[model samples]
Target: WAIGLLEVAFSRYCPITFGIRTMGLMGLAYAHYSFWPIWSIPIMVYAFLPQLALASGISIFPKISEPGFLLYLFLFLGAYGQDCLDFLLEGGTFRKWWNDQRIWLIRGLSCHLFGTLEYLLKSLGISAFGFNVTSKVVDDEQSKIYSQEMLDFGVPSPMFVTLAVAAIVNFFSFSFGFLQMICGSDDNEGLPLQMLLAGFIMLNCWPVYEAMVLRTDKGKMPTKVTIIAAFLAWTLYAAAFHISFSK
Candidate 1:
């Protein structure tokens, strides 16, 4: 039903049709059908690179979202909030002293310093750096970054430089991922890129792995025919990409 609804909603605005049309400007999407497996070979190769990041202390384990955990975060926050209320609205002298002591800590995390910084960074599309400097937008009246007047879509128009910068950032991102896939596993290994490829291969399997490992106890791999079909399809897609840009 969701797929039916999506088809109804986007039938006229078909993205794949549009995407293929865009690709036609350079070359047909299916121009190179054979080279995909070669490109995807590295996907498996780089799959282990993230392990290097973890061993080197630069990354952390993935946090798969679990149901009901958000309720826990909210409850924990509410309990803390209630404690704050008891220290504030409750009239005992000791309570008042305690509230004064904790006020700075609360103030620091509230819509104040660090929270504002976290919001700012997310807005800039700089999240790849792994820093949360700011969160939601501050009201114009309260924000000094923009004037009190002009506003559209709750965001400013995209700047040319912003697009260029995003492209550049994405280029480095692909380079880093590719580098990990091609590079050293050890002293005898050539480059570190294989690590990234291993990570990619794991990511490719992640949806099912996560489902069976965490979300469900049942474990099963699809039929061998299906697996081969998936690989061939993925490889063909990769081949197209590689062929289009191999020059």
Candidate 2:
């Protein structure tokens, strides 16, 4: 559904629709003609809910008006609840699984934000370095050290640069939005929802912020990466200011 929305939006923005259609055809071929397992009916229905809701400007059930909080509650239950169920099915206790899954909330945000940065970099002609497999065969001593300290970041990479930039951006965005709310600025009223959401997202990203700046362990961002990230962030802010104010 996300891909379909993107296709529709892009088609509306640009005159060229051939590429979008071709990509959609390729995806269908891979799913149906290739070895990929066809998605179950329930999975397809669940995936279409968000797009359907957006198109109809209502929840899945048309008879129910003003879904409001119930919409968000059901969305969360349909999504993350399945993961919780899976953990229980795998012989994991609910209490322990719930505690462990709390970290993934932050991780999901991190992955999406960094993934956006990666796409942005690619658009600017930067080639992505392929994925590296993390070693899972650590010794007992190494495991203990990692548990007490931080994950190893001995090698500097572009991924770290992206993460640092995102952390700094979230920090300042949340801080400024919070200050505006506290000051009771008129502008805050106009964008209260956005400001509150930014604050919530920043809270979710607290762990990334700690790893980027606060932690002084081997996993902490290197000085050079921090500098580059700060510079890129400043450049982006300056560009945004120019575009907004030049009008």
Candidate 3:
């Protein structure tokens, strides 16, 4: 997120500092914006916002009958289809393409979220940030242990927890929207796209679900992480509900 912001910022401020330059430099600045920060930050922040609003009886997302909703859906499908086509054109297998998609979701929920938060907190002078150098060398004993264990323990706990909570929240949101549609609610019309979005997130979260519920390997999500994620998701829903009623 910072990289993207910095690119645009430089584009704007560099001209004022060093007089006007070619339009090519301006284009270069904007074109250099990192895809991860440009898209993933917004995805991380807004993934559940509209659903939370709807849970609170607030209509923020577009209804299925609305042109905006169709546009949004088409935009998603078009980008996704294009990506798939690119992968196939490059001779990637279906399974590899699917794994790449899931990895994108995982990185968005975990690394992108952390990166954005770190950037903001540092900018606000609330936190200190610096790069730390680590050894690249690996010993045979340690390498063997890591290979044998296949543990996800190397990842920071917060990242795992964030990923788990995102999966759980999306799962619950999709289920809630599904149930509402099945019950024939008047408000179901506005929920289709939201539900579809949630369901898409949930589908990409299959690995997390497997780790949380099915896997017995060392790579599985810990019991504490599952408990924490479930609690956080419930708390978010409860808070949204309370706010809606209070309003």
Candidate 4:
């Protein structure tokens, strides 16, 4: 979807027809396809990167004292408020909406991030995209496990690794930011939003945390996957620290 959106936006064309034709209508169509997918990139970046920076003792978020910061906050709240209203009008419960938000964050962190990377690689002619059809048929042993009400491990493990690392990064970042604010060792007026974002991501990460430390089923995260996630999170922190030091 990300690559397709980029292609369509760059070409300024829409291949899909909706039984309507007008210059303004066409413009709206183009904007819908083009702009919506672009949101995933920033959502993915903001979900993890600033937390990583905070973990590394470098704050890159805007200060609360900045005039534009309140505008950004208002915009964020307005968008989410609209979604909440829509959900309520559609007879959706708040818990379901909350879960929906969690899924959005998860997809942004995993598939959307991967999609953006693949799009970039494709643009640079360093990667080729192809489709692989997965078979739905299961063998006798697999069927037996399914009959026992066991969960399916349909998602790729690497995605779980990414989620695990994001959760870990958010956890420590929120903790560190809180400590810094409490100790008054750092100028932390800018950290409230960052900490709120970290807390929000961590709240949505309960399932990931469960898989990592609680679940004992086949769908539970493997020990090696946790180790890899930890290493990657540490690597991101180290890189951020080095970059801050160099600056």
The candidate that wins on TM-score is 4
lDDT tens per residue, model 4, 189-233: 778778878987888887788777877765567888888999998
lDDT (tens digit, per residue) of candidate 1 on 1-247:
2222233224553434543566653332332221222222232222223333322323332222544445544664577577767766666555455445333332332223332333445456555234333446565443532342211122221211121222222233345545544564333122233333334334333333332223321122223423443454345435544644574
For residue 163, model 2's alpha carbon misses the true position, in angstroms, by 1.3
Off by over 4 Å in 2: 1-142, 148-150
Sequence-dependent TM-score of model 1? 0.20
Specify the highest-lDDT model's number: 4
Please report, as a residue range, the 10-residue window in candidate 1 with the lowest summed lDDT. 151-160
Q: Which stretches of candidate 4 lie over 4 Å from their true place?
A: 1-37, 62-69, 128-130, 134-156
Candidate 4 at residue 94, lDDT? 88
Rank order by TM-score, top first?
4, 3, 2, 1
Question: Which portions of model 3 miss their true places by more than 4 Å?
Answer: 1-35, 129-156
**Each model's TM-score, in the order given?**
0.20, 0.51, 0.76, 0.77
Select the stronger candidate by TM-score from 3 and 4.
Answer: 4
Per-residue lDDT, model 1, residue 162, is 20
Of candidate 4, the 10-residue stretch with the lowest lDDT total is 12-21
What are the Cα lDDT values of the candidates?
0.35, 0.50, 0.70, 0.74
